[model samples]
Target: MKAATATILVLATFTLLSSGKKFRWCTLSDLEQRKCAELSKALLAVLPLATINSFARVSCIRAQNTHDCIDKIRVNKADAVSLDAGDVYSAVKLYGLTVVAKEIYEEGNCVFAVAIARRGTLDIQRLRGVRSCHNGARWTSGWNIPLGFLLARNELLWDEDQPLSQVISQYFNASCIPGVGITSPQLCALCQGPKSYVRNKNHFCETSSSEPFYDSEGAFRCLKNGVADVAFLDHLTIMNGTDSDQEEYELLCPDGSTAKLSAYGTCNLGRGPGRAIISRHNFQKITKKFLTLIQHLFGQNGKERAKFELFTSVPFRGKNLLFRDATQHLQLLKDKAEISHILGLDYVALLKGLGHEGSSLDNSVVRWCCISNAELRKCEEWALNIKSDPLVCVQAASMTNCIELIKSNEADAATLDATHAYIAGICGLVSVAAECYGEGCAPAAGRTKKLTHLADKALPPVYAVALAKKNARHVNIHNLRGRRSCHSHLYSPGGWLLLSRYTVGALENNTVNCDIGSAYQSYFWKGCMPGADKNLCKVCIGGGEMEGAKVSSRCAANHNERYYGNMGALRCLVGSPSGRSFGDVAFLEHHNLLKNIESLQSSGWAMGYTLNDFELLCLDGRRVAVTDWADCNLGPVPPNIVMTRPVTTTKIYGFLMKSQETLETNLDSKFHLFHSQKYGESDLLFKDATQYLVHTSHLDYQSILGDPFFQLAESVFNCTHADILEFCKQDICTS
Candidate 1:
C-alpha cells in the first residue's frame, strides 16, 4: 500500500513538471528512431536543469524517408528534422520549411566535394566515357556538386525537357548512383546488391545498406575495387577511406589538373553547405531554442556528456543517426536567414539547373536589346526565323539605355563592346557569352597567326592598331602632339583607353592628373572624339555631312556620327569622296582593318586607295604596313560580351546557343548571325567579324577584360569625374 502511493505521487509530479511545449523530431529509419528515443530519455533527465519556456518535452516521430519527413513536418505531425544540404534546398523551396540550426563541422558549415582517381588514369577534362561513382542520387558532394561543375564548365549539355539522369547516363560509360534504380540502368551498373537477389529480394540500387555501394564509403570502395575510374565523395570520406597506398590515388581538380589526396582544400569540385535542422515556419523560434538547449546538454562539449552523447551513433550501430557524426555542434541560425543564404547563390543556381526548384531553361521569349534601327530590324528577322526558341526585339537609344533596360527586366540580353561591358557589369549585369572572331575561339598561338585552330572552336582576342595614310610622311607616332585624331568612341577600349594610356598617360609633357579627357583636349589638336565636347568634335562629319549636307548628327556617338565606330574612324582617315581627309590618324581594332578598307574601296569613298595605301603607325615611332598589326598594335582587346540580368544568364545563354546551333545545321537558312551586309550596314546586331559566341558564364568582367585592360579602364574611367561613371553610380544607388 505504501509503494503504490509513492508511484502514484511520482506520476502526478511528472505530469505537472512536463507542462511545457513538445518537440517532435522526425526520424528517417528504425536506427535513427532508436537514437532519438535515447536522446529523449537524456533530455528528460536534464529537463529540470535545462528547462526553457519554449519546449520542455521531447518526442520522436518515424518517417520512411527525407521527403516523408518533409511532408510530416508540413502537416504539423513533426516539429523538426536534420537534412543534407541538397535535401534542405527541396524542403525550403518546395515545402517552405525554415532552417533553424546548421551542423558545423571541423571545416565550418561547409564541405568540399573532391574527385578521386588512380594516378594518371583519368583527367577531369576527359570524363566522357569514364566510369564514375557517386554517393547517391541527388546527393550534395557526390552527384550534385561535381555534375553541376561539369555543366557550368560546358563539359555537359542538358536539355531541360529530359531528366538530368538521362544526360549523365549518356555522358558516362557507367556509373554507380544508388537510389536512382532502373531509371538510369547505366548509373546502376556498378552497384553491388545483396548476395541473394531472388530469395532475399533485389536491392540493386537502394539508398539503404541493402546496396553495397550506397554512401560516401561505398562510393570510394567502388573506386578501390577497380570498377570505377573516378569516385565523387566528400573530403572527410576521402580522408577516412585512404590507406598507406593513398599515394596511388589522386584528386581530379576542376582545372584538369591532379593533386595528392591531401590537397582537397584547394583541389575540389565545389564547397557545399553543411547539413541543417529544419522546422515548420511557425515552429522556428521554439525549435531554435529547444535545439540550443539540447545541444548544450549533450553536444561535443556538453556539460552532461557523461550521461549522453548527442553526436555519436555507436550504440545504435549506424552512421549519422540523428545528425552527422562529423558535426562539431549545432549553430542556431538568425531569423532572417534563408536557404539561399546558407547554400549560396552559385549552389542555388546549380540546384535550379538540376531541375530541383524549377527548370533553368524556360519557354519564355528572350528579349534582345538593340540600340539602333538597323540592329532592331536584324534582330526581328533573326527572331522570326528562329521560331523554336523565340526572341523578342527591344529597342533602346544607346548602349547605356540597353543596360538600364536589361537591369529593369524590360530587356533580356544585349551584345556590348569591351568598354560598354565594363559599364554593364558595374550596373549589376553579368556576361553570359562573348563574341569569337577570326578562325576560332581559342587564344591565338602568336600574333602572326590569326588563329592556330579553326574558327567556332574558341575566342580570339582583337588587336588595336593606329592607322594612317601611307602618303602622310611628315606625321608619325612620336610627333602626334598637335595632330588631328579620330577615335571609335569616348572610352572605347582599343580606340581611346589603350591609345590614351600609351600617349597622354605615358608622355611627361602630356601627363595631367588622371583626367584622360582633359589630357586628350590639351594634347591633341582639333579632332572628332564623338562623345567629347568643344574642340574634340571639330573634325566630326555627321551622316548627312558625309553626304554633303549639314545636320545635328555631328559628334553623336551612334551611327548618326559618320566617324563613330572602328569602320567609321577608318572612314575619317581614308578621306571623303572628294579626297578630303578630316583626321591625320585613326584608332581602331585590327580584326576588320583590311575588311573595312575593302568595303570603303567598293563604296567609292576611297577610289584611289588600295590595301597598300594605308599603314599602321607603330608606338615605337616607326611606321609599318597595316598587315603588320601583330607587332605595331596598341594592345590586345577582349572580345565583345553578351550582358544580361544575373537571374537570366543561364537562360539567355541557352537560347543563344540553341539559335547558333540551328543556324549552323541549317545551311539554306537565309539569316546570317555574324554578317550585316543584308541590312546595308556593317556590324549591325553583332560585329561583322564575329565568327561565333563562346560561353563565358564561368568568368567575370575583370577576368574577361584581362588585368592590364581592367586596370587601364579603372584609371581612365574611375579616376576622372566622367559623365558615364557618374551615371553608373547613380544607377547603382537607385537600383
Candidate 2:
C-alpha cells in the first residue's frame, strides 16, 4: 500500500510539473518566501489527495512589498497573495483584483481592531501627544482602521492633500509604526530592531520581522513592555498574547470609554475583514479551485498535516509568515461577492474617509443634483464647459429626494426655491449661495441681452403676483373661491403657502392649525398645485401634450409637471395650442413673468401670448396691468438659494462663485450657466433670468429668506400641524 501511494504521488507531481500550469504566490520578505517555499513543497507532496483536475504546481514569487505584489498580480506576473484587510481593500479597489478566499480564524471571517492600553493609563478622547504603537504602516488593525476611526470622529484633522503619517506624527507624541520610514521618525521612535541582524543597518521601521514592533504581536509587546501608552491591534492578538494579569489591560473604545478586553466586540475602533487571498479578476475561478485543493490537503484535519502544517509559522521561526498563524481554515467567498460587501459599508466609508480606497477625499469636484432629465442634460453641459471648477451631475426623483441625497453625502449641492430651501435647512442643510438677477440685481430685461453684474449691490427680492388673463373680467382675487387656480407648487413660498396665508388665512380666517394645503384644496375649485393629489392636479398638463407622455408624471412635484414652477404656473394660465386654459388665476413670482411670456410666444403651445395679454389681480380685489406688480403683488418673495450640507458649505460656495465668474465673462462660450431654453426646458437648474450667484455662506435660512418670508414660513410649518415638516423632522431624528 505504501509503494502504491508513493507511485501515485510521483505520478501526480510529475503531471503537475510537466503540465506547466503554476500558481505563483507573492511574498513580501525573505521569511515569507521561505515559508511559501515550504508550502509549495507540501502542496506537491500531497497533490494526489486533491480532487481537482488540471492541477497546478505551486511556486513562490518575491516582491518588494504588498503594493508591489498587488501590481504584479494585476499584470499577471503573480497569481495570488494573502493580504491584510487594509491591503485587500487597496488590491481590490486600486487594482481591480478580486478575493478568492479568506482565512477563517476563531473570530470567523472578520476581526475587531481594538486599542489596548494599561488600565488607568489612557483616555480615548485625550489621545493627543500620547505614545502609540501600531502593527504596521498600512496594516488593518494598526494604522488604517484605528486612524480612520479618529478621522471619522473628528479626533484627527487631515487636509487630505498631505500624507496621513504627518498628521499621525503630529497627533501622537511617538509611535512604533513599522514601515512608516524616515519621513516621520517619531512614528518609529518606539520600534525595537532585531536583536541579531546580519544586514540592513537601518531596521527600526522595516516592514519585515527585522523590526520587533512590526505586527499585532509586536504591537502588543510594545504596550506590554511599557514603551507605548496604547497599542492598536486585533482582538485575537490581545487574546493570544495577554499572558499577564487580565485586569491590568483594557480596551480604549472610539466612544471615549474603556472596557475590559473581552468586550472588544462592542468597544473596538471598527470591525475589519480577515486576511484574504487575492488574484486577478479573471483568475478568480482557477484561484478558488487551487486554494480549495490546497486547504483540503493541509488544513487542520488534513491527512498530510503530519508531514507539513499549513497554518503554523513556528517551525519557520516567524509569526504570520505566509498566512496568519491563528487561521484554522480557508473560507471561499462567493464568486459574485464584491469588495465593498466583504469589507462592509462602514469600514469602506472609514477607508474612504482616510482616502485609502475607492474615490479619493478630494473636494474639488462638486456633484450637482438634478431632478429631471432636462435638468440633467443642462447640468451635464454645465459640467462639461465649466472651467473654474469640475462638476459632476447626480439625478434624483424629486427636489425632496435631492435634499435627502445632499444630507447623506451622496450629493453635494442643488438649487432650491425658497420653500424647498426651508425644508432643506430643517434637514440639516444650509444655503451657500443665492441667485442674483440682472444689473442692480433686478429681474432680467430680455432673454437675448447679456446680463450685467454689480458686485456691491444686494440682490432684489422677488414679488408674488396673482396673474390673470385680460379677457377674464369676473376673475378678481376676492371672488376666486370657486374658480380654478394655478400654483407654482405645493408649499411654495409665493404661490402656495404665503399666498394661502395672506389670501385665504387672513381674509377668511380659515387656516385651521396652519394647514395651508388643506385650506387650498378646499378653497380652489380645481387647479394644478404640483404635489397635491386632489382636484389641484386635475389641470396639470404633464409633459405638455407631447407624444408618449407619461400620465403617472401628472402633478409631480418636479419639472415633470408642466405647471410645476413659476414659469410652469404661467404656462398653465397661457394654455397649450392643443388644449384650452385650465385655470382662472395663476399665482407665481414676478421675477421673469414677462420674459417667460415672450419665451412662450416662440413655443408651439402658447404662440400668441404676450406681456399685454395678462393682468395682475391685486389683494384689494382689483385687476391691473401686469407691469404694476410692485404695488399690486401679494408679498415679497425670497430668491432661490443654493443648498448644501453645513460641512461643505464653503467648498460648494467657492466652486459656484468661481464657476459664476468664469461663465459670466466668457461671452463667446456656448454654454450659459443660467440659460435653459436650448435644452427645451425653462429654469432646468437655476432660473433662466439669473444674472449671477451671490455667496450666502454667512447667512442662515432665515437671513437668506428675509424676516417677512421667514415669519410666513414659521406660520406655514408649525411642526406639529404641517405634515411635510413633521415628516422631515421625523426623518432627521431617525437618520
Best by TM-score: 1
Residue 266 lDDT in model 1? 97
Residue 236 Cα positional deviation in candidate 1, in Å, after optimal superposition: 2.8
Model 1 residue pairs with clashes:
439-454, 439-455, 440-455, 441-458, 441-459, 442-458, 442-459
Residue 670 of model 2: what lDDT?
97
**Model 1 lDDT per residue over 1-735, tens place:** 955754454444344435665679998667788999988787667655534332246778877456668889999999999887887888898888888888888878788899999999988999999999898787789888887678766677776667889999999999999867577889999888754446336566656545667677778889989989999988877655446537789999977899988889999987777678999889887677667666766889877898888998888987778888888888877886856566654456557557776653332568899866668889989987774667889887677778767765577789898988988877657788888788654344543212121223335788999888888988788888888899987777887778876778732333464677788887888788877778888888877444663466677766667777887798888755565647999989998778878887577566656788889988888999889998998889988999876555666787887787777667789998888766656787788888667777767777887778777776667665565445444410010
- The residue-by-residue lDDT of candidate 2 on 13-84, one tens digit each, is 445444567778898677888988887776656554542343335678887556678889999899998888
Residue 157 in candidate 2, Cα distance off native in Å: 2.6
| Residue 439 C-alpha lDDT in model 1 | 69
Q: After TM-score superposition, what is the CA distance of residue 464 in candidate 2 from its true location, in Å?
A: 23
Global Cα lDDT for candidate 2? 0.76
